[model samples]
Target chain A: MNSRREFLKLAMAGSTAAVAAPAAASAQAKPKRWGMLVDLRKCIGCQACTVACTIENDVPEGQHRTAVPVYELDGPNGPSQAVLPRLCNHCDEPPCIPVCPVNATFKTEEGAVVVDAEQCVACGYCVQACPYEARFINHKTGVADKCTFCVHRTSVGLLPACVETCVGNARVFGDLNDPESEIRKLMAQHETKGLRPEFKTGPNVYYIGLDDRLASTVAVGGGARDLRQGLETSAHGEV
Target chain B: MPAVDLMSFDHEAVWRPWAVAYFLLVGTGAGAALLLAYARLVRIAEAKGALIVAASFALASGLPLLADLHQPARFMHFYLGSAPGSIMWWGSWFLPLFIVSTLLLAFMTGRRGNAPMCGGERMLTMIVGALALCILGYTAGEMSVVAARPVWNTLGFPVVLILTALMSGAGATMIIDSLNGEKGEGRYMLVVTGAATLVAFGLWMLTDTNLSTLAADYAPVGLFGGFIIAGVVVPVVLAVSAKASLLLRGVSGALAVFGALAFRWSTFNGAQLMSKTETAFYGHEAALSQDALRTLAGSAGLLILSLIFVTLLINLLAVRASKQTQA
Candidate 1:
């Protein structure tokens, strides 16, 4: 009995060690952590960023890498609109990463969560795991797909397509690890918030002046048509 | 006037019926395998036919899983590129090992007392049983790890599965053994099925203490009530009755099997109904397209086909062994 207990203990420890080892090693070799800040006060809801992201990523029709969902609230000054653009949070502790059976989805040293198309079995585990609803199964590729934070463009020292094309200059993107970067400066100056903060995923995307309507709306999986109707009729309010 | 863009995340049911069917098959298979191993270890002679059925279920569980995958060809990547932390990765490894080991034990047992399993064989059975437990646990863990889905984010999910697996396994064992119309360990298995069902109910009560959207509204009312009526209440009452005919016992066992399948169906589908976001959640309904329905039918057909195939092969081996002994 004692021997059996000992064996179980050792087995448990070994499994834990195997899962933890890679994450610790990756942290030690830390590169520049890329993050984004969206100033909702500055956004005009032009949706140029959305269109640009789709065009740049060659995303199929009826799918989006980034979305600008606008909400209206009843304000003292009458109906006001708040535009909130949503994208992959690229969490430091991504919920989506560990759920992929085939290691198809992983977080880079630079803090972008990426999907390997070739390795993906399209089991959709990551799609279900994501708290932010950031992942979707790509119909054309028959694999899980999501925003890469435009790693291809950012790695080449070019700004992400969304950040470059934002007409209102609402988006600020840079290496969060660099203290001198614009994102770092903005984060220091402004109190920013992440979507669904309670999940504790350690999201990299920060929002300034996030609208209450957009923030407070409970993500209903199926009963959303009524909510969409409510959003359309209500006047927008300031954060 | 600014356009209020109402676009929310896509309400596509990623798991759908394919995933539901896969979970049911795997759980049933694991439960059956564990029971078979236990019977073999104790040298239950009357359980030979059941052993064959159990082993077949265990091995054939891979069918629904493969059918659910969009890229079935990349199935090998589970071995080559498994993410260690993933519960699905653990499942990928645990399942095949369980199947292979169960098959080996079944082969040894099929020799019909000519060559009984030795110490090494018994050891292998124990190990496979242990692996079977892990496989069942992994199935629950797969859903529980998804922090996004509040309904599936608890340990109770796996506990429910474990209990149901044991219950269903006992039922399947009893039914298969009774087919020959010989007196076998039916009463013992009935008692076991009853006990497991009771424990599962206790666990269900505990699971409902903190109800998430998955457990809220119509879901729990149907799920818990359904389990109680079909799985717990019916089986226990039938098992305890004096005039429990073989036909009645068989019916009780069959209910337990169907109950197990229903549990998986409800759990998987119910969890998907709840949204992950904080805003007004978009309601989701799983569309039962003809294609999806056809695939589901195909998966069931595959299970039956494999059972028939394995039985024939086992019979052939038995005949050959007997002929050689006479020679």
Candidate 2:
């Protein structure tokens, strides 16, 4: 009984140390939960973000890192164009991370999901796993590529290329963990919605004034999509 | 009434026909390994043909898979680390081990010169059989875990893959038996498996709303019909009727093998063609580029060569057995 008490005391001490150590470390700096907030009502469908993102990431022609899909929908007034800017959600419970065969894709320390290109086998498993249709196998490099949430600029205390170029100030990005962050403020004020929330992916990217049909799936292919596809195929047949 | 898409890029399928070929060939190989285990257990003389199909197809199955990978050279990354959460990572480990154990079983003869089975050979067969089951499970889990692809996400997808693998492997073994003039036990197994696959798929359609909806909307009449009739029904009919000529046997065998290929093409590749955001499919562009052709050629050639080598080995073993009996 004496020996059992001694063992229990040792176990209790170890558990306390384990709990206290992380708390002490966290005092220095708590890890940031990065997030994006898109205010759809503010967007003008300029395609500036698309063009800027392409230039910033050096994305190939006919492929997208991020693209604004404009849908023609009938509202309370009449038919008007509505835009849903699509990009990698970089979800808290990212489906893409766990599906990677080689453990090449992972969430960074600050909570942005990124792929290690050098280590990637480019099997396209993650590409298929993504519900957002955000990831693609880079035709030039033959590796999985997606929006990194502009980690390059964000880390250096600069806005993402897309955010910087948005004429309407639609794309608001910041650390969700920070109470004073612009994104947190907007999210507090507005009823923000995430795309494909039915999948329960816990998307870090949230939106305001999102249409119900646009959030789920859009009925397409009887309009400009067919013509665009045809022309792209025929025009860029060699590539 | 409908939302018209003014501008959207065409999304190409992440996995192409190369993926379909890999799945079909690998699934067939795993099933053949299972058949080999059963044959060895029952003291069947036709184990070598099953063994050959199992090892050769498993051996050659990696190429198309590598081709499917855009960076085939980086395949070593699969082994450098381990990720338990990933079905694909689990598959990477299961695949190599399965191949090695199968090859070991093939090299160590089961019944030599009509002798009773040796002890080690029996143990190895069981191991190979167990590993074969792992490979089947791994392959099914790898695809079925994709919640994004509604057709593949169903429980029935794995069942159909497994059942089809069993019958297709049986078909392959039967083909070899007919070529060597041996009465194949696979003929009977095929009828059972073919029927099981049909029932499983029918139940799948009824129970799973996602699959039922997808099938209603876009299941191709030609490819899907070909899989049901030519692959399952025709082959099942031929196998049940006894006293079939060698020509018919070979034809059915070929059809069965091709049927497995057709099923993967129509389902695995077909599922990728469907759009998640848009109602209509992102139409298939069937690329016959130099890269695709080269990859297919390389993998198919390896498969052919392995088959030839196994055939010669079988013939040599027969001659040696005859000499021993004469002595």
Candidate 3:
């Protein structure tokens, strides 16, 4: 009976310390810089990540938090398909954050951009301001919603649903701040490029083997003919 | 880089027709208030009639804006909890102050030539005029500061909006003066306003290369052509005509009003259609939903009702003042 009582007291004290440790450490430790890296070479155009994100986030039908836009480029060999996975770049210089009238959308201390639904006015200004076209108004909530990089799971040390469920292991998510992290290792080893780098948003999301046609979205210093040269023929296709 | 077929998803257009209508009415209302204040300050003979119309429009501008909010009941939050960096927060403050000041000015002047021009009245009128210009400028700034829409991302937007407001204001004044048979300095204002709009258009062409092309392609050739022909050419011709009839002056004024409305409609609607993504042009068909139509009609009805109420109130006030003097 005495041992049982001692065990209960120790358990209570241990639980209390466990809760207090993070709060104490958070004040001293630099916030984790979370990011993602996608290998287009390995992506099979299956859209499993898209479906997994939708299911995990409870994303409304006809809306997506992430999308994989497959581009069939006519190469010298033949028509080669390159599936480009797109999501909120979580930009360091997010244009959407400043234009928001209420500051409903903001970047987290952990470097994940998130929306405060209670504060959102549903003005749709943020929807227009995102260069990546990453945001959408949630019809169900009547507020703006977008990819949060699964902060709920990431905060508690779990992989994002898309990364967990990726069939080809193409999606990689980790702390960019951690030198030994897989994302940092891959980034150091490979020449990865961001989508629309000319915008200079410093997008955290990086891509390996991204097509040139897809990168020409923010064409700068091009003449009229040069600008019109590599236009996307599928303007009407579904995103 | 080889040409590729890029599939893009359509984004939710947060600002709908109600928002467009709000911008239109607010811009016109502010414009009208400026004209009325100027006329009153200069002691123009037709200021009384113009004041009634301007005051009515100013009071009615709030309806569409209130309706545009998803939570009308929560509008108090805008005042209570506002971000300092946001232009919208400033707009929330500016719009209400402008409306209240204009309303007071109209009331003070509504005694219909019986009320002597007090120093307080002149001060109020000047304040209203200043506020009206601010409101007009802020509306354009609200759109132009948005970096995503390259069409609106220019300093030229506010200038164009202000010039358009002047044209609309001058057009309203000319219509009121012509109808009441008390034309005074209205024609001069119209000429100046037309020239200013032309200058603004030239500046807009120089500032936004992509939008200028889109504006040329999408902005109605007939309406713009008609605006120049009916609003500018015919008005100039009538002003200098040997025998200028009120009928001809009224027609020109009416066309100017239509042209102002067309400019707002095309700019608001066309900006949304341009593809923000490099994929392709996002096809934006106007929302003709039943609820949307009803809300639009309801907004117009509210404006007309306000006009009628103000007119009645003016006549009643004038009668009351005359009776008191007689007694």
Best by lDDT: 2
Q: In model 3, which regions exceed 4 Å deviation?
A: A1-28, A216-239, B42-46, B111-113, B184-186, B216-244, B286-296
Tens-digit lDDT string for candidate 2 (B242-323): 4567667767777788677767766765578777766656664453556457656776798898788655555566567768
Choose the strongest candidate by DockQ.
2
* Selected candidate, larger DockQ, 2 vs 3: 2
Which parts of model 2 have CA positions greater than 4 angstroms off?
A1-28, A229-239, B43-45, B110-113, B209-219, B287-297, B317-327
lDDT of 1 at A187: 84
RMSD of each: 11.9, 9.5, 7.0
Per-residue error (Å), model 3, residue A167: 2.0
- Looking at chain B only, the TM-scores across the models are 0.84, 0.90, 0.88
Two-chain DockQ for model 2:
0.34
Using TM-score as the measure, what is the rank order of every candidate, best first? 2, 3, 1
Per-residue lDDT for A58-157 in model 2, tens only? Answer: 9999888899988899888998989999999989888999999899999988788899999999999998899998999998888999999888977875
For residues A82-104, write the lDDT of model 3, one tens digit per residue: 67788998999888887777778
Best by TM-score: 2
Q: Which consecutive 10 residues in model 3 chain B have the weakest lDDT in total? A: B279-288
Candidate 1 segments whose C-alpha is farther than 4 A from its true place: A1-31, A72-82, A211-224, A227-239, B1-7, B42-46, B113-120, B182-212, B215-226, B242-244, B279-292
DockQ (CA atoms), all models: 0.25, 0.34, 0.25
